[model samples]
Target: MRGKYIALLVAAVLAAAAAGVGTAYVRQAGRPTAKTVLPTHEDMQSFVQTANDWITERQKTADLSLYMADTQNGWRSDGQNLFHTTDGGKSWDAAAPFYDGGAADFLDATHAFALAKAVHDEEALTGISVYATADSGKNWRHLALSGAPYFSAEGITRGVDGFSMASSSNGLLILAGDPAAGSHESVVFATKDGARSFTKQADSLRMPNGQNTLALADASHAYLFINGSAAPVFMLATTDGGKTWKEQDSGLSPRFTDVVPTYVPVRMAADARVAMLSVQNGTPAAGAKGKTETADARMRDVFYTLSPDGSVAGKLTELLTDLPLDAKSVSMPDAQTIYALSRAGGKPVLYRFQAQGGWKRVESATLPADALQLQFVSLSDGFVLQKDAVFVTTDGGKTWVKRPL
Candidate 1:
């Protein structure tokens, strides 16, 4: 009944747009007017409520505006209603037309995208429905997959794992399916017209641990880093728009018998030229014997640089190995400064690395974890998005202030 109610409310908004009743065709952010359906506050009364006891859930935020999955009537359902807050997670507005599930790439404050994919019985793939919000989720427009397949192969459950958008009109979606034990393979699809349409790519990645992270530098270049099922750091690079992908050697290959690196991906990022990756390295699995939990092994977290096209470019650099296992890459504001976030003990801690100096405990953020991504548009201007709070920093990572959600 909750799903039906949400669906009816969305339909009513569309109906109003059709009848030209209460609507705003104002061209914001160079948005096309033909398919725009502006959602009103009253039309989405279900989104805003007096701050209740229900715990808010977190997803990737679209720019600074947070996209949340809040329960209807303080009760969880099959699908939680999507809501957005532009004012530092203060008052949320209903982004009802857009579902809050699946992989999302919130490009900026105005443009965001997601794949509202459908699966059956948690096994069989069902549909590929893509949606985009050009006006920051104020209005979401449905995009045609045109004829994109729901599943790249026969599988019971398929999920949109990630989105890498190089620009407003060019992007890629990776779907993980064909689960085995707990891991699955990945299928690729892309769009060139701001997701107006989509087409599946010929290339797919079949790794033991599947894809770890995908970053598209441009329309022609993309990099996929795996959890190194075969090596300490395994990577694939595509130069021909993913029509072909080739393995990249990191020069740190581990021997199966003499040497095997136990790798745990901490965080990684890449541009068109160089890729930055950090991994938590346990003792050499092949020869560790009984020294697997040695202090030296626990402190072997490393930072590496490689060519974005899949070649080793720089020597291995080690970071503060004491970082939490869930430490995520924050930003590379400059060549000498780096930032990372670790959700250790359910709390977020920020760390900064300075070249020639070392890593420093910047600030133990008060915000909660399960935060999708911490982004910095500039050197001092950065944001830490929580479920119901936003942490803003202006002096690099030295201090932070929380904002209401």
Candidate 2:
């Protein structure tokens, strides 16, 4: 229902890599100490980086790619191995599984789906392949797609660089030239019947040209977010399942001179009408002829909320504009209650949003500065997944109890 976990977690992993530290030392420094009550920004960064590495290492060793759990059940897989639990992630049972090492989507306890590369001649990738399991990963079957787009003809091979599965049957796949070729063109394909069939969405979506991702509220409602090097960010949405899509004109007119607008979608609300997008202004570097420029040192960590109809309805809010910390997660439990977490001044800061008040800091002695992900099942019941453990909160993060995985 919310955006996928990998979106924010990937940034955390990069933060660790960029900091040039290993997971072992980072984890050791992350422990809360009696002498140091609050972790500094560097401490929190190490914690995040360590946690990201822990998860990655666990996935690799355990042969699992993801972990998804509700109140009473959980699911995990790594393409080759599959595991499920009935006791709220306390223990898991191994099942016979198939490995594709591809992007997967889970609808319920028994049904799951994924999209992987379909190669011909045991060496050449010819098209995108679909796989499914209805018995909680006990077994899987490759489904035949009806309208999938292919870039392979004659001697050329266009590979599937990006793929997203929305539901058991609906998904999108992007085809492009060699990753080293620096091609700006891409094609998108859509499937509605659990990958039993597909329809070519576009040959060239243009502007946010190549790299892309997907966010879907359901089988009928989905959005495509595109990322490009020199182009403005773009978004496309479909209300009638995946039958048709229209670009959500991001009315991002930069107010500052000598710069251009670059908007990135951080989180999309459940209603799909409201979304939080990160805004950055880029200025051409000196002697680079407006061709190469670093992020304006003056660029503030600004975020704005807009409607799918392309209206900036919320006041643009800036957090620690003087610092370089960026937001990792944003959650809207309801239409009015929004929560966000970001790194600033070398520490993680939590924020709560009110109707009239923009965003206010949440102050608590027990609040964690090293959380990797936040999952709010309700207004009062939420879970914060960290590097070494998971924490449960019933009083809206005022207090927390460590829950074992």
Per-candidate TM equals 0.63, 0.65
* Model 1 C-alpha lDDT per residue in residues 108-189, reported as the tens digit of each score: 5566666565433344446666787777577777863422364434453345445667677887766666567644667777
The residue ranges of model 1 lying beyond 4 angstroms of the native Cα positions read 1-83, 118-125, 144-157, 180-186, 203-205, 209-211, 228-233, 255-297, 315-317, 325-329, 334-336, 342-349, 354-373
lDDT of 1 at 293: 25
Residue 283, model 1: Cα distance from true site in angstroms: 5.0
| Per-residue accuracy of model 2 over 154-244 as CA lDDT, tens digit each | 3243544445555567666555644434344556667777666667776654334344456565555666655433334466776765446
Native-to-model Cα distance after best TM-score fit, residue 85 in candidate 1, in Å: 4.0
Write down the worst ten-residue block by lDDT for model 2: 20-29
| Model 1 clashing-pair count | 6
Runs in model 2 lying further than 4 Å from the true structure: 1-69, 74-85, 92-96, 108-110, 120-123, 144-151, 154-169, 177-183, 207-211, 218-221, 238-248, 254-270, 280-328, 356-358, 403-405
Residue 335 in candidate 1 has what lDDT?
A: 48
What C-alpha lDDT values do all the predictions have? Answer: 0.46, 0.49
